[model samples]
Target: MTRFSGFRVLKEALTGHNGWAPLWRNPAPKPAYDFVIIGGGGHGLATAYTLAKTFGQANVAVLEKGWIGGGNVGRNTTIIRSNYLLPGNQPFYELSMKLWENLEQDTNFNSMVSQRGIINLIHSDAQRDAYRRRGNAMMLSGAGARLLDVDQLRQMVPFLNYDNARFPIRGALMQSRAGTARHDGVAWGYARGADSRGVDIIQNCEVTGFRVEGGKVQGVETTRGFIGAGKVGVAVAGHSSQVMAKAGLRLPIESHALQAFVSEGLKPTIPGVITFGAGHFYVSQSDKGGLVFGGDIDGYNSYAQRGNLPVVEDVAEGGMALMPMIGRARLLRSWGGIVDMSMDGSPIIDRTPIDGLYFNGGWNYGGFKATPAAGHVFAHLLATDTPHETATAFRFDRFNRGYVIDEKGVGATPNLH
Candidate 1:
């Protein structure tokens, strides 16, 4: 792999910029590998990178059904934060935030990590108390937080409708370190890093079935042919249930479509990521001058990457309720990504019933923010055969064991989560 530097850029510039090579190799799958990751998205590529770079795994392969960066890794609204009140989620996400801080240097690829901060608006006294508790939890986990009153919030984001007729803004929970990253850049960087470490990234190769014998996973059957592996890790996001079903496993997950939108280019107005307390609306300004925003997932089970009209209207209503000024901005485009909503609204990363077969899914709305740590912990688990300390609570049997990490206290309802 070529080491990228300012000198390299200058040299390439002098030579008409023709000496640059591909970021990663598109390799064909080998007959066997020591480890096989079943998805090529951010989490899968990050897992492969960590396995090779940190765990010293030499023989590894990442098999993707389509081209890389063509999934949720690129479809998300790009917000990254660790402002959780739950023990199972806060520390893990903080680890990811730390990783995001160093990702560009570590991978030698620019991921455009912008820590412009995020504010969760508070609408009433009860909401203020809840945000205070959540802020305290964030502080305890070494993540920064601040409680800002209505005056302070108004100074920071004066465009918001503070004196709305229905839900007036009272305060906010601010996290100075929480922000967003370039989604596709994240996927490409991890893929390049993993490929440089001799990890085979085989695209256009779909896993058709698991090659299990006598309750132990031997490998997987793919469209390219049978590729053997000592252990198999499944991280295929929203398609978790369908992929696992090929191995006779039923996961406690449902697939739902989460829609995101971008508005026409405008002058920089939004200072940072901001979310409404009374609704699911969140908005931020992209580097390209577009207003990037999104809200709740479509309330229906869907394998398709498109949402219905009801969710579109609901999201627009939420935005209008928060910032009436946005009513004038024209929407540029909108799209959806299938999310794997777990029963308890948290993620699951654990060993399955089949020996040597690991599972990582049930991310709900937290997948993008959790990518780096998810990769690190999942790699640690696959490398050492033990769960990482921060990820110990994300177990497969937690549901049946009655130890659900109901982060939102929404019970087992997938849509509500």
Candidate 2:
């Protein structure tokens, strides 16, 4: 089970603001680009930036229907860690964490990247065994991680419930290198860097359909007009399936709501990212003294960002469990975003059946933290037309081949993992 980070309650006490806001400016289009990236979220922006930085400028475009950073880029709880339980995903995520190490220097965007330590709590013997295996895998991969028993857990999280009602702590998987970062800064930094490199950032341009030729995708047809591309790539998380269907393709992913909330501002109480594996809960505190967090998704498909009440109640209940002092904290606000639930918990980053087309999606809840890593690996794929060995298992046909990398072995609810 995941442990509650105990930061959400502190966010409610904040008076003046929600965390990140959107910045949208209408601009004219350039004649052409080397690559056209659809979806202006963190991954899309990062992809464009990486392409320009590596492949050189004058051929990249990021098209967004709404605005950059307004999608899941800003909507996620912003947890950045590589506590995955598999081989392919674990190393890939560790690489992403390495990029995040110098993102501020790379993009000159003060992302406020924090490495205040993150812990995954275990509630059952089964979970302890899983943590043991995962920890050993990390050690084998040369990543630093440890499995802490109940005694060590108490030292790490003194406020936690040692003896509990619903569940009790047995042990925890701790990765000292894991943490969170500012989401908007990450997007804006990449945007500014990519823009300086002459990449076009197009907002309010919705791709209505794809323009294909002899089984090759030539360009895209948008609400504004027809624009041609040498190749087309879709990185839209929430609307990935919708965009792919325009070309007669339907991914195994379904859009679902993942809601998050903040408490009124309190003193910087909660320190780092926390997850309650046994329950639907997680929390973290931002530098601004606001606790930022959410729990498991709503478990239903919906485009609406407004979530139901039960999730909020569940989150608050979990928060109170970890930090009883937060019982009186006022819930300031809550919002949700559409998550692209992949068939397996892992992401899908590979070539599809459509020629001259590609994908950088199936993120589920892994978007914000994996931004730089996604951009780098995806750019490598785009430029070389080859899968980064780390992402080879995340191909589209894995589902059909029965080569599923089900990290949590989450059966039907792909988003829950």
Candidate 3:
């Protein structure tokens, strides 16, 4: 594999850029492997890379139905943050935040991780109190947060509708290390690193069924063939239920389509990520000067990868409510990704009743932000039969044991979170 560096760039530039090699290999699946990962998205690829690099498990294969980055890994708004108020979530996400801080150098690829910071705008006194509590929680978790008063917030983002009588802006909970990254770059970096470490990345090879015998997973039946495996891990995002159903195990998750939008390119207006406290809207300016933003998911069970118009309207209303100037920007395009909404709004990274089968899903709206930690912890679970230290609370039996990590405190309702 070719190492990318400033010297390499200068050399390639001098040589007409013809010395560059492919990022990853498109090799055919082998007859069997020590481990098989069933998703090529960020979480799965990161898991594979960690298994190979950290755990020394190089005899691995990642099977994807479509090409890498075609799933939620690419179809996202690219926001990354660790602003949470829950005990189980705060530490894990903070770990992800730290990983994002060094991801580019660690992977030997530029992921465009810009820690420009993020703010959750408060609209009222009650909301201000709530955000203060959240900020305290974030600080306790070592994520580092601050409370910005109205004047400070106004100076930071002067274009917001601060005097709106309906949802008046009061303050904000800001995290200086939270920001965005190139979604595609993350997937490619992980894939390239995993492939460089001898992990076979089998694209267009979908897992059709689990090859189980006597309550143990033996391998997988894929579109290509029955690829034998000593252990199998699944990280499919929204299609978790359907995929796990093939193994006779039901998951406590529902699939919902979450839409994200990008507006036409213009002069950089939004400095960093800003979220509405009164509504679900959040916006950030991309390097291309396009306003990238999104809101709540389509409030219904769905396996489709596209969302309906009601959500589009709701997101637009949220952006307009937060910054009235957003109304002037025309929506350039929109896309959706199937989100696996777990019962408690927290993720699950645990082994199943079926032996040799491990599952990682139910990220809800926090998938992209949690990619690195989710992968590292999940790889820790797969490499060693124990949960990662920071991810001890994300277990499948949590709900039944009354230990649900509900960040929103919304009980077991998936959509409410």
lDDT of each: 0.93, 0.81, 0.93
Instruction: Itemize residue pairs with steric clashes in candidate 3.
Output: none
- Candidate 1, TM-score vs. the true structure? 0.99
Model 2 scores worst on lDDT over the 10 consecutive residues at 1-10
Q: What C-alpha lDDT does candidate 1 achieve relative to the native structure?
A: 0.93
Q: Which ten residues in a row have the lowest lDDT in candidate 3?
A: 271-280
lDDT of 3 by residue, 7-107 (tens): 99999999999998899999999999999999999999999999999999999999999998899999999999999988898999999999999999989
Task: Write down the TM-score for model 3.
Answer: 0.99
lDDT, candidate 2, 1-417, per-residue tens: 111123533553474435423332356666555677899889988988988897664588889888788999988877898777688788888889889889887886678888887888899999889888988887766667878898987876777776887778787888888898888889988888887777788998888998888898888888677778876778999888889989998888988898999877888777677788676678888776777878878888888877899888888888877667777777787899898888787788898787879898888877778889898888878878998877888898888889888887876577567
Scored against the true structure, residue 400 in model 1 reaches a CA lDDT of 87
Pairs with backbone N, CA or C atoms under 3 Å apart (clashes), candidate 1: none
The TM-score values for the models, in the order shown, are 0.99, 0.91, 0.99
Flag regions of model 2 displaced more than 4 Å. 1-26
Span of ten consecutive residues with least summed lDDT in model 1:
272-281
Instruction: List candidate 1 segments past 4 Å from native.
Output: none
